[model samples]
Target: MDEPVLEVRDLVKHYPVRNGLLRRSTGAVKAVDGVSLTLDRGKTLGLVGESGSGKSTLARVLVGIEKPTSGQVLVDGEDVTRLSQAGRKQLRRDVQMVFQDPYTSLNPRMSVGEIVGEPFAIHGITPAGGRRAAVGELLELVGLDPDHANRYPHQFSGGQRQRVGIARALALRPKILVCDEPVSALDVSVQGQVINLLEDLQEELGLSYLFVAHDLGVVRHIAHDVAVMYLGRIVEQGREAEVYDGAQHPYTQALLSAVPVPDPSVRLVAPSLVEPVETGVSTSSTSGGVGGGAIVLEGDPPSPVDPPSGCPFHTRCWLAPALPEAQPDPIPSYPPTDRPDAGLRLVPAVCETDLPALVPRPEVGSAAAPGDVPAAGPGAASHVVACHFARGLAAPRVEV
Candidate 1:
């Protein structure tokens, strides 16, 4: 198999919280906590989560915008985080970023040409056909008219500004692009156009993308692989089909179930399907955590400054030691010998004591037959999940 374009291992980033007049550090907000994943060359890895789930922080860490607390960010086998100044400059050429807000990301003062060609100037490399020609080429490549390269950023629409951002990122001909919600601010109709544009650019240039976004629908469209993040860690990851269809993690399942179905008739027929999680599961029978219905997550996520001891999700986890009836049958248990923490299998005790590692589960029936499915290797058929009970309660494949 080809080498992965980007690989992150045990990536962690923390910001200190200060106090009083002296501003002494009191606590640290755990942003990107112990994240690890691999992005194969020319593939897109969609990092999805709600706000504060550390999606943006992870993207920043990958592109070298923010230094990691501790971890390895290997770009094509090179540890970029530890690279020296000159090596880091060269690294910038190999990797570029596209931010969420095109309006703010682009400079209002610079013409589209200047914005796109700034990379060449910064790297001290003259464009093949001078700066103007090179800038024009980039503009056209991102689906904008080369003639419009002389226009200011304010002259373009939201989608057009995003196209400019893409043009700028491509100017350096970077092998990897870390896109932080690049289309989040665009109009719904325009979002598809930009997404298609990105897909086209990837195929044409053989670019690998670390696309971060909150929308699963967008991720589903762009990502070849998907990694579901909770708090500050990846709870589930696998090929797009496997993760989206047979979502094992309760969080992943909840996220998928909440996606708005377009069929009006289906919504009318199964109105209960669209209702909040608490509405379905009786509160009396289900005491703690969000109930059985649709996995509606309750309460704000735990403070990152002082996250819950074992599982960060335990406080709001629907599967946590909740109602007696809602308790998972037979209880979920891992071998006492393998992990550092073992034999701690009370409803929330095990989850609270041991931070579950992302591990593969058995594939669902039919969509992938037992013998037909490939073994969990670097290639495919690897649907890694984190929650202890997710395996036994794996949701069936539901095509979007």
Candidate 2:
């Protein structure tokens, strides 16, 4: 097997919080905590999560827009986190990013040609028919009219502007594209065109993509593998079929359950295991889909500045009650007040004390029989879940 073109090993990105007039360091926002994944050449890895789950932060780190707090980002076999100035510039040539918002990503002042050709100027490389011809070729490649190369960004539609962004990203002919919700800002119809364009480009160019988005439907359509992220950590990951068909993690199950189904007659039922809670926070499309019965979590995700101990998702996990008995004792109430019920309800002691590792579950996969654990294949070992009771949890029925 060919080596993965991109690999992330326990990547961690954090932002420090400051307090007082002296600007004392108070705490840190634990965004992109201990993330690990591999993107094989010419394959798309779709990253799905909620709004503040640090999806964008991980994308930025991969494309060199933000430095990681710790951990390794390996491009090919080389570690990019510790690259020198010149090495960093070369890294830019190897990895590129497509920003989410088309309106803000491109400079309105510059013509489309200048925007796309800017990479050549920065890298100091003149193309074979000169920069003008090369820019025109790139514009054509992304389905934009070369004649419009002289036109400014404001003259184009949102989708057209995004094509311009893609053309720009391809200017350096980078090996990997870190697309951060590239279609989120476009209309539904235009989004399909853009996604199809990306697919065609990947087949034609042998490009590897790290596709990040909130829409599970889009991910299901475009991604070969899917990784479910929550509160900066990947709770579950597997091949698209394995994940969509046999999700074990409670978080993954909830996300899959919320994906909108097209059949109007098929009534959506809330998963039997999940007991919906009314936490003032709206139970909207947390995963960016509409029309299905959502597994509405209790309360909003905890603040990254002070993430809960043990499992990060334990606070929101609906399966905690069904797990084994809490070891030691349940967590004490906050403020350490005299009353035992002074703060939040007690969770399973184990869930509140020990973090779960992402480990393989041979029993869970696309090919496994209902209630039967399949023998672990080379690919099946990659189907991993971070929940402690992953093996005990039954595969979630998504389309009921």
Candidate 3:
């Protein structure tokens, strides 16, 4: 199999929480914790999750904008995490990022030409026909008029400004693009145009993309592979078809259930393991069979600085109650005296005690016999999920 253009192994990025006049290190915001994935050459990997799932943080770490606390980020088999200053400069050329907001990403003071040509100046590379000509070509390549190179970012529409950002990212002919929700800020109509432009650029430049977004619909349109993240961990990952057609994790199912379905006749239902608790906040229950209503997850995500002891997602997981019983293991930090008075709820004890490993599932069309696990590697069709009860819970695929 051909090598992956980018590979992240157990990547972790944390922000230390400081307090007191002395500014002592207290806890860390566990952003992008133990994230592992591979982005194959010329393919797009859609990283989807809710806000604060650490998607953007992971992207920043990948593109060298932020340093990771631990783990490896390999570019063409070479670990770039601990490179020298000069090596890091080369790493920047190899991997560039398209920021989320077009309005703020570009320098309002600089013209489009200057913004696009800045990479050449930083790298000290002179294009064949000078920087101006090269910038003009990039502007045209992203569907903007070549003459618009002289225009500032403020003069362009939201979509056009994003195009300028893309042009700047492509200025150095980078091998990989870490697009951190690049189209989320644009109008709905213009979003498609930007997505199409990205598709065209990827095919033309042979660029591999790590497209991060909260919108599953956009990801479904462009991604060849899908990785569903929850609370800084990938709960499920597989090929586009495997993930969209046969998602096993409860979080993935809930996320897919939330995708807007245009048809009025079709309904979306997310079955819960226990009776819906009355928390004032609206929640959704199973509407008879599995077919449309959003699975309104109860409670906000736990604080990253003080994440749950076992599975970070176990608190809100709907499938936890269905699993078999195990010994209870309470969190050491939150003793009975310190626990919240939300009352008690029934869930599998193991769900709060053991963190399940993201293991490959049994192959499609085959019975999951004991010890029958698929091997995960490049080009392998292994559907990996990090749920203890994933083997018994075969979630119905929801087409967006």
TM-score of each: 0.84, 0.84, 0.87
lDDT of 2 by residue, 217-300 (tens): 899889999999999999889888878876777777667656667753232332333333333223444331124345555578
lDDT by residue for model 1 (1-400), tens? 6569899999999999999999999999999889999999999999998899999999888877889999999988889889998988898898899999999999899988889989998989897779899888888888899998889999999999999999999988999999999999999999999999999999999999999998888998899999989889898898988777667665776676566566521210111111223432322223321232233566778888888877677666555654454454444453334323333333444564665456566443223221222334554446787766554323434433
**Candidate 3 overall lDDT versus native:** 0.79
State how far residue 288 of model 2 sits from its true place (Å).
Answer: 19
Clashes of each: 0, 0, 4
- Stretches of model 3 off by over 4 angstroms after superposition: 264-289, 322-347, 364-381, 396-400
Clash pairs detected, candidate 3: 267-291, 267-292, 268-292, 268-293
lDDT per residue (tens digit) for residues 1-400 in model 3:
6459999999999999999999999989999889999899999999999999999999999999899999999999999998999999999999999999998999999998899999999999999998889988999999999987888999999999999999999999999999999999999999999999999999999999999998988998999999999889998998888887776766776776677778633434333323333431233443411442566677898999888877777777754543334545322221133223212222256566655457776543344531344446555556788765454334445443
Better of 1 and 2 by lDDT: 2
Query: What's the alpha carbon RMSD for model 1?
Result: 6.8
Clash pairs, candidate 2, are: none
For model 1, the stretches where C-alpha displacement exceeds 4 angstroms are 264-294, 323-347, 363-381
Model 1 global lDDT (CA atoms, 0 to 1): 0.76
Model 3's number of clashes is 4
Scored by TM-score, the top model is 3
